[model samples]
Target chain A: MRLRADLVPQDNLSYQDVVLVVDVIRATTTATAFLEAGASSLYLTAGLESARAFRDDDVVLAGEEGGLKPAGFDYGNSPREAKEAPVGGKIVVLSTTNGTRTAHLAARSAKHVLLASLYNAHAAARLAHQLATEEVAILCAGKEGRIGLDDVYTAGVLAEFLQIMGSYELEDGALTALTTRRAYPDPLEPLHLSAAAQALRQVGLEADVPFCAQIAASPAVGVLEGRVGEALIFKRA
Target chain B: MRLRADLVPQDNLSYQDVVLVVDVIRATTTATAFLEAGASSLYLTAGLESARAFRDDDVVLAGEEGGLKPAGFDYGNSPREAKEAPVGGKIVVLSTTNGTRTAHLAARSAKHVLLASLYNAHAAARLAHQLATEEVAILCAGKEGRIGLDDVYTAGVLAEFLQIMGSYELEDGALTALTTRRAYPDPLEPLHLSAAAQALRQVGLEADVPFCAQIAASPAVGVLEGRVGEALIFKRA
Candidate 1:
């Protein structure tokens, strides 16, 4: 399999058979947690208003606006909270600063889109490699179209898992990510140094960093099913 | 002192007191070499046509179109050639694929602009640190607006040198670069693995890689003076 990792997604990213979108400092981790917690489906909205529009008795609203829980939301973008939420068989409507927007972008060209995080990195890599027809791309949900160190390091973890499953040529971004991932033996070292983690800490969400850094904590893989209106829906695979 | 490394120059980079533009594959190296070889000034153009416009008998035209010397140019983007050229006291008009364009962008906001490469990495970093009043940004001249591993590694080298000069807070990109730089003991290892080096090898310019990888080979620091028409002029500082 041919493999590439875009440290940050851009308008010029080419099509791939399998695309893994990673947002380790919350979005992807939270999404994976929701899936692992037995949520039947997760709808990723681009903004708060769209996510709030899905408010219903059967749906749980979960997301963050500025690293804080939005007003009246069921939960903030906290994986720990997501893991503990009793959402089995219920649909989750989510929106965040970066990850959801990146999912929408990844859905534009890839044959398959899978949400990836340190929480489910191994499982996501295995599923993606098994499903890839030829090319596989790991796209980091960068902060506001910039390379987020947290996401890049998470991409490195997924890239490492993918390489272990098979022989694949690595791109520049992939090589950089691998180098970074290898440098920090502890996941929290790099993750805590990231702007994302610092932002979370500034908002009294410091616990989320360690929770998000738990590598392979979940075997669940959140695979993009299809788009329903403005939200891209994901289901456990 | 505040230090930041932009692995790839983007639209969102904030203002900095000093900006060091690095294009390790060839551009900045060649420019530095020309100044070291006693060239009076180097004019950086964004394209081939503008470089050709400076076709005066006294001016030496140098640049690469696609990893190869362009037709009618005095030399390709080769630091080795620049070192040996009889460009003493003569003006050299240069245009390159990525480096010159990045310099133009850097000139837009920086109080001081310096060309950096492994050839003059130490001097460039020192000069930048000395010239900076508040923030210093190392801008990597990435390949076609994408992160080039060679440039990123070069940025790391510069960042390392800057850190040695004093204590400076690092941004995420700067931290990533420092990690990458620390991982490679030999500069040629990462440089050879880069897509930029692969392209150069494909075009039979493999010799340029080692030449560009020579750390601190030259003490010459190319400082941007001002612009002349479509070209940004650099002089030895």
Candidate 2:
């Protein structure tokens, strides 16, 4: 098996069988937590309007634009909020600056798209390795189309998990990610080092950094079931 | 001052004033070594035809297509070859798979463009820091448009050099690069771990990896002088 980590979404996704979309600073962490918190399904949208359009009595509109919860949204892109919310059997509509759009973009090229974060690194890697035919790509949802330290670090954790299950050939990006993962043994260190973490700090949402770094706290592997319009619908695998 | 590393060429070059183009596996390494070896100038072209077109009695046509020297070229993109060649007071027309094209692209966006490698990492960083108006971007000429561990590692080394000269704000990519640099203290480790190194080894040019990894081997900083036809001209600073 070949494992590659794209620090950002480059033009190298077409050959991947399984792609784990990572936005560990919050997006994937929150979405995975939402599912683990008993949300029936999470709808990932690229824009806020699309996420808002899905809001219904049972659907929770959740996400952040620039580290702030969008106007009138039910919750921010916070794993802690998603975990605490009474979302049992309810659907979640999420739109974030990087993670959601990245997931949608990756979904177009990959056969299987799995949401990954430190929150569910082990489970995501296990599911992706089992589902992969040849290549498993870890796509980091870098902040605003730039490389994010948090996402790359999470990718390293996921790559390490994948390596334990099977023998895999790593690409340059994967080697970089593994090196990053080894550099910071504590997940929160990288999460704290990221631009996303700083953005959240500026917005007084600093707690989310550590919240998103809980390694394997949730066993939920958010798998793409299908799409509802432009929104990708993910359900726990 | 602000420092950032683009692990790959992303769409984020507009804000940069000084851009250090790094392709440590060979292109930048060879170019820097050539300048250090008393070459008058290096003309960087993006294609084999353009490189070959500049061949003359005084101009050395050099570079590789896929890790091997092209037919009828004076030399492959090797630092050792550049270091030992009788390039004194001669012009070398060079083209490679990634680095030359990357330098051309960056020259269009940056105020100052410097060719960087492990060969001149410290000097390039010092020159860039001294020349920057505000932001200094380390642009890794990633392998065929994907992240190369060797270049990213070199970027990290450059970023560290900049830090020693002065205090600067680090962006996520710079942070990642620094982490990568820290993970591989011995430089040659990341150089050998890169796919670029593997390709070179397969082509029986394994010596080039260590040759490229020799830190600060050259004091020459290949600064962009101007353009000659489609080639960007560089001379030692």
Candidate 3:
């Protein structure tokens, strides 16, 4: 087995059999929390218009752009919001700045796509290992064109879990991630110092910092099953 | 002051005032060794043909393709070769796989470009600090568009030095590099475990590993002053 780590979701990411998309500062964290909180499923859309169009009585519109909730969105892109929202047995239509776009892009080429964060790193890694694929790609949903520390740190956490499973050959990026995880065993330091975390704190969302920093808080893994028309449906893995 | 770290040289890197291009596992390391070995100056070129075309009585063609010296090249891309070569008062024309290509790309936009490696990291950082440019970019010459552990680790070493010198806002990549440096104070561990190091050992070139791992072995910083016709001229910074 071979494990590859991509610091950012570059254009050509269609080669891997399984791809774990990570946005630890809260997109994937929120998604996993929603699943763990009893949301039936989620429809991940990249554009705000698609998310709004897919919303209904049974669907909750959750997401943020520029760290602020949209005018009519039901919830902002916060794990705290997902934890408190009425998501039981409901389908969540989600859109955000980076995470959902990365998921949509990964869905184009990846046979199986899973959302990973510190909250669901172990579950995501176990699911990837269970798939028994030759290659697993961990794609970080970096902020804009640059890498975000929190996302890469979360990728390191996932890489560490995958490495512990045995019988895997790690590529350079994987080794880098593993080394990173070893260097900082405590994930909270890097996350608190991350640009995304600082932005959240500036926006008076300091509560989200410790909330998103929880590792393995949820055993739920958000797996992209397939597309339902224009929406990418994520089922619990 | 702002410090930015790019794990790999992405396309169109036309943003910084001063760019420090690093290839820890041989190119920049070898170049630093050559300059420190009493060579008057070195010429860096990305293409083999360009390296060959610039050769003259006083110039020696040195480089490697796929870890082996080419048929017509004067020397292979090895610091050991450079350290022993009769390059005294001679201009060494150089070309390698990743390092030179990254330097060429960085030259397009950067006002000043310098070659950095573990051998010359401290010197490079001091030079960057001395330049006092508003923005400084550390571009890692990654292996085939992927992050190379050796390069990133060396970048971290440079970042650590720059951070200690003055107050500067670090971008995410810079913070990641700084964090990496703090994680591994001893540079040899990551260099030995790097993919490039394994490849060198496979080809019976394991001797280069320890030679390249010596931090601050050379105080010379390879600064790209200008081009003579087609060859890039490097002076001691």
Candidate 4:
């Protein structure tokens, strides 16, 4: 099997096979934390109207624009904020710059859509390996419309793990990733860092990067089984 | 300037600053050699009929399908066959897995499009850098529809040159190319053994790998002026 990576546009979610949506600077990490906290489900939408629509009935309306949580929303794309409290029973609506669009695109071409973060990377890779039929594609939430190193680096973490476990061959992108993984002589530093990581640090979320950088900390695999209201929830398809 | 690498479908060749249409194994190498021979102007078409349409005293129908040159063609996709004579004054119509499609794609996006190979890499990079307008994309033609390492490696060579010159900042897929270039301790050894390189060697073109591998050899860059019949020729636009 082969792996392909694309820095897709907000509307151009062109993909096939299993689409692994990554917004490592925060979206997926935050969502994983929300799942860990206690949120029963998440409503992932491209627009704020969807979050506002679901603002009632104990819903935590959440969204991030340019990395910061917007006004009036209960939360932003903060993994710590999401994981800090117990959300096991509440529903959270979420949105962000790159992650949300990736979710929508994955839905268009995937047999199964999955959300991956450093937190639950191993489970994500293993599950993808278990269920993948033809090939595996990891779509990074590149900053805006441009490709960023952080997401690709995060994708490399998962892509490499999957490659080793499944003995899969990779495309040039994935190979470059594996090579990048080896580039940083420092084992402590991540293969790459995201703009969101820097922003979170500025907002006094300094502890977030290491947490965000922790690969496969969560063993849970988040799959986009269905869209509830507008949020996508992780479930077995 | 931003540098990026893309794996586009053979059909989609329209959005790039400088398209490095890579048929690393054969197509492009043969075309480059054909240009070295005395071909006046080459014709690049989507099908064999288009090539035959231009087949006459003025044009030489040259291409391949499933590796070997098709029957009744003046030559195959072999650089060795092309090198038997000089091609300073004839047009050599062509097509292959990666190069032709890349040419079409570059024609759509690049204000100035150029053909690159190990034969004329230094010149190509210098030309690409000189003509680049804040964005330069290298399109690598993989085998069939896969991401061939040879093209990606070639792209890496270009990226390193771009970075060293301080004229470009790597972005999009090109950043990944940077990773590929740096990943290996020794590039020529492992990469030259890749399947794409092997295919070239099978045709007795093993020496070309070293020539292609040489950091910066020939500095003559091939730019596409316009669609002249079928083949793409390098000319100032």
Candidate 5:
């Protein structure tokens, strides 16, 4: 088996059997938490308009723009909010600045797409190992078009888990992620030191810092099942 | 002062006072070793044809394509060959797969561009600290527009040196580099584990592997002083 890790999703990605999209601090983290807390499924929309269009009695609209809850949204992109929401048997439609875009991008190219973060890294790795067809791509949702430390650090963590799970040849990007994981063994260090973390702290959302830093807090593995209209539906695997 | 580290040069880079382009595996390392071993100067060419065009009695042409020396080139992209060449008082023109392209790209956007590698990382850091106008951008000449572990590890080493030399706020990329350096304190580990190193070993150029791994082996810092038509002229600083 071969594992390829990309710091960000690029336009030229070839076909992969499995693609794991990571957005720590805290998009995928929140989504995974919602699933673990009994949300039936998540509709990952690429924009605020698409997410809002999915509003219904059985759907909870959650997302953030510029780190603030969009006007009239049910919740911001916070794992704490996802964990506390009354999401039992509900479909949570979500959109965010970076994570949703990455999910949709991966959905267009890979046969199977899984959401990964510190909350579900190990679970995602295990699922990937079980389903991969000789190749797996870990795509980090970098801040805008640039590499974000938080996502890269989480990718490193996930890469390490996959390395330990099987005998596989890793590409350069995977080696980079492994090296990053070795550098920051404590997940909290990357959380506290990341630019996204600092931005959150500045906005007085300091509580989300430690919450997003919890590694494997949720056993949920979010796999993209199909698309419902303009949203990609993710079911827990 | 502010330090921004990029895993690879992006098309939308902002203006910087000083840009340090690094390709640690071979190109910049080889150039630094050449200058340290009494070469008067280097002419960094972006293409094989351009490098050949500059060939004269006082100039030697060198480069590599697909990890092999091009036919009729005076030398390959190997520090061992560069170190042994009698380049005293002569100009050595070089073209490589990645490094020269990065040098030219940085030259177009920044006031000053310098070549860096593990061999002259400390020297490049010191020079950047001395000459930067409140901002320094470290651009890693990654392998074909993707992140290369050897270059990023060398960038991490240089970022650590810059942090120790002055008071500066590091961007996320720089912080990542510093963290990587902290993880692998011994430079040889990254060199041996890098994809470039493995390729060199496969090609039977194993001697260049350890030679390129030597930190601070050369005090030469390649500063782009001028351009002769399409070639960038470098002088040791």
Candidate 6:
């Protein structure tokens, strides 16, 4: 499949088979934890405005920009916050700078769409493999307008797993990550120099580093498929 | 400086003080040859319509879409074609589906840009190092939206040179190449299995793989920095 990791989202995503959107860092990871914790489907919006405007009953409105929660949201894009928040059996109107926008954009093209993270890398790969009608494209939610080491690194990890599976054809994005990962077995060594990487590293998120670095842990698969308004990913499904 | 190999010339270009664009398949390598052969400048446009409309006695309209030369263009995005053309002391208005687009896009962000190819890797690196302003980001012109292996492979060679120079910050893109080159030192192994690699393998350009694999021709620095219309690149200018 064709895995494309573009900084900007194209309105007409060339997804036909199955499309997997990965926001591994904080968004999809947070979404997976929230879903695994018994939260119902999430309604992802591209921005904080649409999310804040939603007034559905029993829906948890959450997200962040520049790492801070929106002015009047009930939650932020933190795994800890998702684990602790009361979101079970309720809808979530979520929004984030990059991840959510990617999900929304990817949904426009694929026959089936999924949100992936390190937390759900294998599951996403497996499901992506099974459900892929033609090709699979993995879209990583990069930071701002530059290359975020975390996303590309995570993309590399997923690519490693996918390459091992040995059935599907890899598109450019996956190849980019796979070749890159092969090129640099240890991606963390260089993270210290990046502005965003340094910021995350400074916050003692070093724990997350190793955690995310692990090949595939949670094996959860989050998706944004079908009609668009109703975002749902059938995990292990 | 963050050195990256982008197969496609969208955004997420590493803002190294110096930017190197590689179209290993042909355009970039040929562009370097053209400039060395004494072409004045290159104007990279997105489509044939714009490239065909150019009217300048001193300018040679060149390039194509889908690998075929546009009906009215003077040249196509092929190094062999460029080598055969008469571009001495003339501006070449260029437009290719990928390379020119990349050049156009990179010019929007990079402070300085250059075109590098297997034909001129060492020369470009030396010039890039000499022009070092802040950092160097290597932009590769991939086939379509995919990251071409040749570009990444070439980027790896340049990344090592930069790394040896010391005191430079390597972006994930550059580091990815540096690490990849180390993993598979053998150039003929299809190190990354990327489509570009496969394409080259199909055409027996695999030998070019080994040639581009070696870092620096001992002392040949492929230094190219220039502009074409609004898009100013290191090599085409």
i-RMS for every candidate: 1.2, 0.9, 1.5, 4.6, 1.5, 3.2
As for candidate 5, its clashing pairs are none
Give each model's whole-structure lDDT.
0.90, 0.90, 0.85, 0.67, 0.85, 0.63
> What C-alpha lDDT, on a 0 to 100 scale, does residue A106 get in candidate 3?
85
TM-scores for candidates 1 onward, in order: 0.97, 0.97, 0.93, 0.82, 0.93, 0.80
Regions of candidate 2 where Cα sits further than 4 Å from its true position? none
Give the residue spans of candidate 5 off by over 4 A. Answer: A228-230, B37-40
lDDT (C-alpha) at residue A215 in model 6: 51
User: Lowest summed lDDT over 10 consecutive residues: which window, candidate 5 chain A?
Assistant: A7-16
Which residue runs of candidate 3 sit more than 4 Å off their true CA positions? A12-14, A228-231, B38-40, B228-231
Per-residue lDDT tens digits for candidate 5, residues A27-125, read 899999889889999999988998888889998999998887898899999899889889999999889978888888888879899999988888999
Model 2 chain B worst lDDT window (10 residues): B7-16
Please report how far candidate 6 places residue A40 from its true position, in Å. 1.6
Report RMSD for candidate 6: 4.4
Chain A accuracy of model 1 expressed as TM-score = 0.98
User: What lDDT tens digits, residue by residue, belong to model 6 across residues B193-217?
Assistant: 5565565566554443444444333
DockQ of candidate 2?
Answer: 0.84
- Look at candidate 2 and tell me the lDDT of residue B214: 95
Question: Residue-wise lDDT of candidate 1 within B120-159, one digit each (tens)?
Answer: 9999999998998898899988887678889889989999
Worst 10 residues of 1 chain A by lDDT: A7-16
Which runs in model 4 stand beyond 4 Å of their true positions? A1-19, A132-137, A143-146, A163-166, A169-173, A185-210, A228-231, A235-237, B7-23, B142-146, B185-219, B229-231, B235-237
lDDT, residue B200, model 2: 93
Where model 6 places Cα greater than 4 Å from the true spot, the runs are: A1-12, A55-57, A164-166, A183-196, A201-207, A225-236, B1-7, B11-17, B37-65, B68-95, B109-111, B186-237
Model 1 DockQ class: medium
> For every candidate, how close is chain A to the native chain A in TM-score?
0.98, 0.97, 0.96, 0.89, 0.97, 0.82
Q: What does candidate 2's lDDT look like per residue over B1-237, in tens digits? A: 999989998544464599999999999999998998889999999899988888889999889977888999989898899999999999988889789878987988788999999989889998998999899999999887789999999999999999999999999899999989998879999999998999998989999988999998789999999998898999999
Mark the 10 consecutive residues where model 6 chain B has the least summed lDDT. Answer: B215-224
For candidate 3, lDDT tens digit of each residue in B55-74?
78998889988888877989
